[model samples]
Target: MNKLIAWIVFLSLALGGCATKVSTSFDRQADFSRYKTFCWLQGCEFTFTGPSYMNDSAVVNNLKNAIIKEMAEKGFTYDDQSPDLLLDFHVTVENRQTNVYRFEEDRFLQLDPIDQSDVYYFLEGTLIMDIADRETGQMIWRSSASRYLELNPEMTERNLRKGIGIVLKKFPPKER
Candidate 1:
């Protein structure tokens, strides 16, 4: 039974780690089908905090390439001048402290609460992608992906691409 309990705990944590938290929102009245072209807004730059790697030019370029590929796969052409949709990217980092608790239970069905509270501080990064109507200059769609940053350069780049893909998958929001 102890082995079973251990396996259950391991599987639970493994599955939880595989889950990617993604969210998206859009203007309901916006006609997404009409958006066929995109361009980066003038003076666009990624905003970030924490380590330099988080805002490294190479890293930023890699992220942009990933986004461009995803957009093209979605049937949008990149137009330098005169585009239907304008795209913007922003990265925000925050230090988050979370407290985790552990409990002890007795065999007699009694529960004992101990002050086993553990506090963890981690850099939480958010990637925000905004799409707006080029002519009206009004945001029509937005997608955001957030994750704790703590990995090697290669893994970080991989995760960045994965995060962007997950966020953009909800593009052209489904009809009601």
Candidate 2:
């Protein structure tokens, strides 16, 4: 019985640790160093050209501010006109349902209790950031991150910042 309980606890902690995942890709031919100035283009939906999801201004503002700060820290100037890079952002949220099952052994070694099964429904959010060349209008770098969201605004902002920081860490790919 103790071994079963320990196994259950270990599984629970492992599943809970599956948090945000971030991935990035960039054009190899593009000279990242040439991107000195950037300006915000309207955030896209998914196709990179579709209308943006602007249902909440507060959320949008928070994201824009975070991106600006991150870019500035990377030594990129924010320019509205004639910028070297154009930055576009997109966000999506999905409701995910997961079932967690707990098991108990019986004397027969075949019977197990199913009463510990739990269903969880939570929001998973994805944010995509694209950097494109203003002159050629070609995408140079792109990053996308997906993570579980918090209900509180403050917590949500903190998570957003953390996610963005992680995604942009590899920006301007190191010269080889």
Give the per-residue Cα lDDT of candidate 2 at 71.
82
7-90 per-residue lDDT for model 2 (tens digits): 575567546856768889999999888789888765322123212543456555666677778889999988876788888877
Candidate 1 has a TM-score of 0.72
RMSD of each candidate?
Answer: 4.2, 4.5
> How does residue 152 of candidate 2 score in lDDT?
31
In order, the Cα lDDT scores of the candidates are 0.70, 0.70
Model 1: residues with Cα > 4 Å off, grouped in runs:
1-18, 43-52, 99-121, 149-157
lDDT of 1 by residue, 35-106 (tens): 898888663443333356556777777777777788898899988767899888787767766554444444
